[model samples]
Target chain A: MAASTLRYGRLRVVSAVAVIGFLLTSCGGSSDASDEVRVSAASSLSLAFAALGSAFEALNPGVDVVLNIGGSSLLREQILEGAPVDVYASASTDTMAPIVDGGLSDGNATVFVRGFLAIAVPAGNPAHVTGLDDFGNEELLIGLCDVVVPCGAYARQVMSRAGVEPAVDTNEPNVRSLLTKIEAGELDAGIVYMTDVRSASGGVEGIEIPDAVNVAADYPIAVIVEGPNTVGGRAFVDFVMSGVGQEILAGFGFVTP
Target chain B: MSRAQSSHGPSRPPIAFVVLAAIAVVFFLLPLIGLLARTPWSDLVSLLASEVVADALVLSAIASFAAVTISTVVGVPLAWVLARVDFRGRALVRGLVLLPLVLPPVVGGAALLFALGRRGVVGEPLYEATGLVLPFSIWGVVIAVTFVSMPFLVLTVEGALRNVDVRFEGAAASLGAGGWTVFRRVTLPMIGPSLAAGMVLTWARAIGEFGATVTFAGNLAGETQTLPLAVFVALETNRDTATALSLLMVAISLTVLVLLRDRWLRPQ
Candidate 1:
């Protein structure tokens, strides 16, 4: 019985893998050269960049668009470690500095859009959180992104500006994970990107940051100098900097840089 | 008999076999060598002195010790039950105890979160009544380590219990020794080496545990962030701290294994 149960478990995992592979294969072209563009962007750009990717794909039918979105620091490290990426879009100039300093980027990077931090709480605001000051309340459970990530860096700056040393319950690796906890109501509040609030739909509600205490995040985009598909990389970067891309980003609550 | 043949003398192996074995050793040693080679020896003292490294090392020791202690207290009785008691659903209970051995630590952590997090099934009511939360706290780290490492001790002691001659336990019983007395005297002495071995195994696993601890406890400095979590977060922004923590972990774990190997691992 145990052996048969183990076999059944293995069979389920195998079938799950097959289904995932089939879905991925159906997503886009399996061709080479300018046929595909692999863009690695920060998590904040997920919705905005994905929109641009679809629009760019619509414009250029033969070329496929693949995006790898994650924390800026992690994405930058992947690039440094020679990940197969064509375009590099980061949440901060500091994060992009490594690529440019290493001569791995093609010339100067273009500032695309800016992001700002906001306190996100679960819908209905059960915690009755007001602002940054409320974050310091001992009774509330709060989350902040780890300092290494861009969102966390901005949140730290904001906290210092506000002169509030709030006790944190969890230091999530990235904004997405913290956002997940907040939306699930596990945390009373979390500091995340304004775009994250917009993308959360009704699951989470965003509490605006006062302009005086808020920090503006600088986002930079560059084409990889050592890329296998330089032309595709430049085109993707161009598309992201284009008017349509800016509009799409604005629709996602990103400020025009 | 086959093992006795190998222990007879230091015999020469085939050239191909020697070459392959050398390559395997080098393959494993290469990464450790690289870590050592990149050590900023000049700043080692200052790097270790930093609050991040200091707090992480202290927390790792405390959490792992707590995990080992708790696992011994709870797991010894469990091993005895699984080994000696022939009860209904015994196999199922045994399987559940050993499940963590095969399950991924991260998945184990996720299950822990669902069962013990503030909004968790049992956790929700517990917190409502008592105002206790587990995740993102020091106790959470201990719980995570214990959850993943308890199996090491349980399995080791269970194996030892099953191998012991039942006549010894029966002899103690016939001599008017109570159940608890027999367990503390005859049964325990019969498995002395196994108990020591189990404790060491639990300590080793508990100290090295990372995935479940991070996932369940959530990394927060001076709270839930143990050495592994500290090394991980440090790796992103501070290479020096990461290397220092890594070197410390390797040195400490190696010392433990070396110190324990002869004491408890030797065969009778």
Candidate 2:
């Protein structure tokens, strides 16, 4: 009786393994499709591109546009490492340079939009942060994107131009994270794109930096050369440069390039 | 013949099991091999000598050690109580203790922030009372590491305590030894191996923590950026530096595992 019971247990285990194997193989096989256009965009483009993605989808039915948004440098690294990205939109031309140099993209990346830095503080401005000079206040907790990211570099440029030495409390991995901290009231203030402050929708308030000290970030969009869906990739890039796309971006506080 | 076979060990006749195990081993080895292939050996010393690497190494060491120390002081007693005492909602208490083990570290970090961040539930009051802030500070790193690592120590020590023979402690107590003295003189010595293993495991987990530490403590060099956070940041800007930091972490973890091999790897 015990022997039969043991054999029955083994049979159950083997059948369970076989069923799991079938499910895994089926899942993998179904997910790989040329109709899916994977676009990797910078975090700052999240809301704008999301709107563009839906509008593009509505124009081109049967082609699903999946958006992968993250730090511009991080997305560039992923593309260079061979992530299956069809469209690549970066927050700065600096991040786009490597992709073009590596021949990962189609070599012609048009500057789609321009962004400027602004001081972001939690709602009600508890720290009373007014300008770039207040970033040097040691009593306040200040956050900035990591220096490698475009936003961080731009923020530093603005701070240097304004002659303010920021007393940084943390170097967040991405602009979104810096914004999150500011919105959460964990950070007294952080330097982020003007669009990000608008996206926060009252969670945080923005203090504009003067035009002289502010550096405009050039956003570039291109189609990956080796992307799985090159045809769909080109279409998406063209749509982004279209008048409707520009209008959508402008509504998000981005300046037309 | 069956008795002799049992004494030798259970017979391993399953070819499928052996094949699956080999695949599992290769799954772990491939990443290490990739890291090794990409590691820049010539620039390793200089990379390690750089200020960023040095600051991260020092901060990681300080936070990990502090985490282990705090876990030992508080976790051992909690484990003892769980193992020795029977109370209502004991299962619930055990579940709460194991929650961190199963929780995604990022979620755990967010939870910590909600409770201890500068404007957090308790943190606002704490700041009002003492003018102290935890996020983006070294203390935040230590606290985040400890919150995630303490469970390992607690689980190990509790298991050890459950396996221990209480008769020895009872006899010692009957011989005029106070409860604390009996525990210190008898229970501790008996569970020393497991305790050491638990502490080592806690230290390993603490040192390698990334998601929680980055989320709760924030990544700042010489303050909250542990080795894992440094590795993540370096990966974006400099690949070689990231590889070097990863190799250093692997070496540290390997040394700890090898040192505790007798207690953990070949448990009798």
Candidate 3:
């Protein structure tokens, strides 16, 4: 019995070590490279920043640009929790406030671009949604971003300015998720950025919210103070504010700030 | 129950085993310690009393209890059929039933949406016939939770049914008891402990369901949002409120487990 027990113990230890070795190898990728610049950008900037990242990499050889795209508020929370992010770009200045207040940014965030809210509906406009006034129609299934998110805040502003009380069915976490539901026909209409409607490439149709009631969400970018590659971070932020970056933003239907 | 019985059972575990076990215990304890350390003690009462928390609690209770009731109604019969009835492709049927247990809840939610959403294959006809939309409603929350939780009940009860002695049931039937009476008098009593365990586990899983509920049901306060969804939204907007909610869930779960320790944790 003792002999068998000892053999079992030896086998268990060997397997444990093998498992640990496997995990270490799988997790040890690009983390030790000092030339990598990690940028966390808002999901709304996905297309614009993908182009920007490639352009920045082309200009700076041996410097890899990695992009982490998510909701602006979520990214801010992660940065506050000490995520190793070199650059941060948000869809709204409100989300950047926490980073600035926490002293996590190297300097004040600069407004890079602006986005306008529009009513997004599935192709063919199944609900026959015409304007912001339709948002108050309880008959249609409408979605909006959560109140805390920038797009949601802008949408709420636009609705209030128009004096339309929207019968919101669901509050998605971000603009992209809301757009997805609209595209899927799960939602009849949603409040999303003009850029998102463009990004959908006919999967959805956009009903323009009159400029008189629309709110332009200011996009901000900042370099992290404690990021490992502050130089690269600053360069990326500068590139975003440069003429080329403005062109890319314009191409994606954003208003250059 | 005595030291002498434990001494005769086996020799002391190997030192490596004891060390690894200790590490495992610490791994589980550390997270609880962190949660307790960060919990907002002073604001907890007020936070708990907030409208968001109150709505979420009531919704969670309604959805989870509804889920348990539905699971018990359908899952027990399925478990019995799987354990007692032999048929072609039984293994395939069983695998289909257990798929949600292994699939990510998000994937499960997406699948549910594809099948039940407004534009879904059957949903379109169903909606046209009745004008009954499921998503973003309380019914959606219950359905999402039930889809993810029923597998636990089915697996638990099936295992118990398989272990139950068929002779006792046969004897009861031979004494002129009907099939249903035999099952109720003999088979059910034999697996009573496991049935209770399965119901408790189903309730726990239903309450903690997040990914599927959010993805399929969508987040709407006082309608589809449950405790887990409320906790997630709070995490992004208010950390203190999120911590307070987390502590509340932990306390409630621990109390339930402790209160029912003898029913399922120990075997007679």
Candidate 4:
């Protein structure tokens, strides 16, 4: 009887341990200091932000920066969904305006750098696309960023300004996708940020638009109100708007806002 | 009364089955009902009529069908070998076959890129020999879809093959049936429902495939943009377009399930 009782006690202990293990595995996950800081930024700011992130990490002793690049709309959704993000930057005032209005962010957003939309052609200027008017060629395959993105909004601004109804073969999700098409020679021309052209590294050539059609892109950033690391978040945001940030942004060919 | 006896019985199989079925029905049907509920029916016809949406639908259907066909062709032979043949490292091969499913779809895409990109190992020779570039094209979509989806076909068909009687094959051989003939006439006929079910699963998986296709095929509209990719692109900027596209995907998937229900879920 004592042996049987011991056996039952042992079984209870085993089940208890298993339950604790299961709970620990499923719930109460690990938290430790790591180099990575998750930054959710708009897709249009990917090039500029990546360069800035690398430079920021270089100056900082141990902290590393990782950029989660996607549509500003999507990033907003993620932030709303309680993703573990430290910094949020967007491509447009319109996109950023909503985040600010929703009271989900702390501190007012500041525009650090500005970019203008330009027509990007394949390397060596294969299409010899001279100006925005060059996009009117029906034979040339033009890719545009979809209208929801800041880049797309800029492109539409330029097209409407020029009063040209150019044929668009594809509407990509981000500026990088448009750049990829231009680089592949699949698209004769695309509209992307001037900074993106610098990042492309000769994969595509940028054709500046006339002032009349050129629409400036503003980059806005804010800290999440409910972030676990508000200190790190605010520090990162300050570093981005600092002279160091300006240098990094300029190195990527961004004009000051 | 008969009802009282049934209810009071110790083993209430019918009642248990009813509860399980109710749970299953709610599990699958609720999400679809949610989609229908959220659908902007007022704008449905116009959204469907758009050329971009039409192109994506057609492309998705074609690519998914092609993916399922290729998976079926390759997976069946691989399944037969796995189930029937005794070979060295058979367990290793089985593990490798399941590698893609276990892998994150994005990683699988990157692996495909390394193997088949313009600067890839096989791609360099392939370009020189046949002037064929595997990445950034429609065929690349097929290859990506096939890579991630073949395991479903293989696992299902392999399970069916294992349960089939080997004595039938031995009898067919004694009756002067060649190996190929016996497989075609005897084995295939037995596993026909299994193959059908596997193909349906494969088709559904391919339709929903997004990561590998986007990475390998580069998401050029009318080229590599399947419905999922198109919906992703739409969701980036336009919430309405994304919702409309998602509703369409839900509708078609449900239609396929209903049409193929008996074949998909019938007991062997």
Candidate 5:
């Protein structure tokens, strides 16, 4: 009985394999140029860097910019795994420190832009949260970045400086998540980069944090020592530091470091 | 003369079987061995003592268990329907039920956001009606895990139900048993093993569900973070804790598999 029952199920295994094979074949074939700068960056830079990628392509027609945006910690792990990457622009120096320490770079690390952390609330601010002090209220659902990421570390720094123990309802892995929470009103407020507030386009509103309680976030860019496109990586780094790069970064609300 | 004949009749190839098994064992065990060999055992106790690991493990267990329970409650009946009832669009429903399995977990998380996020189509009214939010909460982790892992239980139970003979119910009914009593007395006991196996698979899937959990629930240490989330966070700063967490996950999964094999799959 068992043997007969199993025989009737054999078609399922075959069909599953066929479906997987079809998907693999469809996904495996792709056509793109080889000279593209495979730049892996932090997720927070998605909106700004997407615009920058197109602008860079226009500036250098022969080169394509392949952007892999993710959490800085995750990006660093992939780089450590020896992924085919050229330039790595992280949201914080802490994430870049280990790679640079391991001699994974050609010593081209530089801070290109600075960002200030601020409290972002929904457009209408229904919670009536007046300032940073309101974050201490247990009733207010406040989201924050996890301490593993740069944004979260900065938020921690800001909170510690104010001597305020903010009641964090959740610690998101990235700023975008925190932004989503505030915009969706799942959270009354979240601490994110000024640029994030700009990119949110007023679905959320920003409350400028007092300088005494704000932490500065810096972007560190470097060329991988084992990068296939070392020349292009260095060139891209220089391009981002030049006047045009500053303009682009500034357009995203990044203050010149 | 009969004992002598029985001894040689068995003729088991012990040497070849053991050698082949040894090679397979090493192939599978080497990576785990390497992780253990590299673990910083000196600081292992303190590392585990860290509040973050504790929080993450507790959260993960709660969410994963909740997910498995929810999946079993909802999925088992659906499996019975699929296996026993001939209905219109049944095949399409089966395919649609497995959609979460085929779609990448990240995509599942994105879909969850569209459905349950504060600004979501359904979530908006829910929030406005009761000031309740689903995303970024402990409940969100359960929802994400259940969405991705329920299909495993459904498929398993459906397969088992299909194999269960309807004659047992018929026999019970002919003996003057009512339908509900017949089903309870006849059908349920036969497929108990498969149901247990399905529960184990569902639990394992829920425990390992990372992409959807992180994307939808976000990684809040005591609130939304589970073991996989803990492993991820530990990977960020401490390599030793990451390995420990991973080994713990592997150990739990292996233990569950062994228990299922012993308790559910052994021939009666």
Candidate 6:
């Protein structure tokens, strides 16, 4: 048994070496010789940041801006794992707290924009969803973001305050996923950011949550102190907080800082 | 085979082989060790007893068992046709059957949504007529798990079916036995070990199925949220809860593999 185990162990080693060699070789020639600034942002900023990245590149000829977007908490986790991100922009300060404490950020994080929650449904409101109260109606197929994210946290708070424990079909990982499911008609309705509804435009209809129960999501951005390109990272952060950038965000229905 | 492997007789092992082997072991085992070292051992029991863990565990077991059963009933016939029947495009069909083995599970889930979701191509028509939707339901979880893990059962059973000698069936037919009798008494016994092995593998894969299930069925507690989905969500908020849930999965998977290793891998 010992001898057989040893043989299998050696076989595993052979395969492991093959995989490692393949990975190392696949890192082929770097695509950008120019200084590349990597920004890890929330999925909510996908459209907004794509515009910002292009404007930054057009201004700085020798530098390229790369945007990586996903759920805020997941992005923060990647940064904590030493991801080579120069700038970390999250939908909420809650997700950015750990990185700041770890001293990975250049300084205090900045709140750049705030997103409001909305009841997102298919165009024409086939589900006939009207107010936040419908979120508790078991007959409606509802989706919400998980509590780990800014949207999800706000979603839960709003639902609880409205005295409605929603019968959630799923807790999506990100705002974009919730929007996609809603657009696909897989979900009758989902609680997502107003900006997401604005981004999707014709694909979805946003029912504004009443001010009495509506939640405001604060977005935070910071430059990573240990990023590969600190100068480029700082530049990107400044550009995002710029008036021009704020206007671009406002066009997407984001409340500016 | 044992004698062949024991042949240290011809050449000495290379030094680089030993060095790389040690590195491989460390690379694979370090994360496991780290997880164990940082475990809130004192709180593990309480964490396991929580309502969320219980709900997820029950849901996972029910969905996985259903998936394995469905895979066995549906997959065995497909495996038989692929292995024993000679037809045009047989190789292409075989490759297609094994597609899920390599496809990313998340992509598989999205594809399922495109096909089975309410607004999906086929799903829209089906929903309009039958008022039945698959996503965000227990059935959706079962479908996603079955889609990804059934390939394991099919490929294994197909290999077993191909290897069994045909003469045994012919010899049995020469006697008074009918087709069903011959198959039940001969073909089945011949592939018993592989069948058992396939079911065990299928069960393990279904239980651990995550990405596809999350994507297709979603992450709703007591509905689509299985153990893996539960662990993932917990990982964001409560590390201790996530670790405890992960430990449950690791322990279950390890026990299954350890207890059935010989049955699955031993020579027939």
Which segments of candidate 5 are over 4 A away from where they belong? A2-33, B1-34, B113-137
Model 2 docking category: acceptable
lDDT of 6 by residue, B136-190 (tens): 9999999999998887777777776766777788899999889889879987777
The 0-to-1 C-alpha lDDT of every candidate, in the order given, reads 0.83, 0.86, 0.85, 0.77, 0.81, 0.84
Candidate 2 lDDT over B1-268, as tens digits, reads 1223444355775899889989978977999999999999999999888888888989999988898999999999999999999999889998898777667777788788878988899999999999999999999999999998888788777777776678888999999999999989998876776677778878988999997888888888888888999998998889999999999999988887786765443323
Q: Which pairs of residues have clashing backbones in candidate 4?
A: none
Q: In terms of TM-score, how similar is model 3 to the real structure? A: 0.88
lDDT tens digits by residue: candidate 1, A93-205: 99999999999999988899998889999899988999999878888989998989888888989999999997888887778778767776678998999999999989899
Q: Sort the predicted structures by TM-score, highest score first.
A: 2, 3, 6, 5, 1, 4
The list of candidate 1 runs beyond 4 A from truth reads A1-39, A46-69, A227-232, A242-251, B1-24, B86-95, B98-107, B160-178, B186-195
TM-score of chain A of each: 0.87, 0.88, 0.89, 0.83, 0.90, 0.88
Quote model 2's iRMS: 9.4
Per-prediction TM-score: 0.82, 0.88, 0.88, 0.74, 0.86, 0.87
For model 2, which pairs clash? none
User: By descending DockQ, how would the candidates be arranged?
Assistant: 6, 5, 2, 3, 1, 4
Clashing pairs in 1: none
Kindly list the per-residue Cα lDDT of model 5 for residues A1-257, writing each as its tens digit.
74345324423432453365347335444344567787888878888788878888899889988898988988998899797788999999989988899889889479888888888999999899878888899888888888888898999898888887999878877788678667766688888998999889879999999987788888998999887787878788888888998899899999989
TM-score of chain B of each: 0.89, 0.90, 0.92, 0.90, 0.88, 0.87
lDDT for position A78 in model 1: 83
Q: Report the C-alpha lDDT of model 3 over B51-156, residue by residue, as the tens digit.
A: 8888999999999999999999999999899999999999999889867766778778878877888888877788899998988899899999999888778877
lDDT of 3 by residue, A102-141 (tens): 8999879999999998899999998999998998999999
Model 5: residue B243 alpha-carbon error in angstroms: 1.3
lDDT of 4 by residue, A1-257 (tens): 32233333333433443353345335445354655677898876777788888888888878877788987777877787687787899888887886788787896888877888878888887667888777778766677887877788889889999988877756666776667657755567889888787778777888888887789888888988876666777888999889888888788788877
Local accuracy of candidate 4 as per-residue lDDT tens digits, B138-203 = 888889988987877887777767767778888999999999999999888777666776787778
Alpha-carbon RMSD to native, per candidate: 6.9, 5.9, 5.4, 8.7, 5.0, 4.7
What does candidate 5 score on TM? 0.86
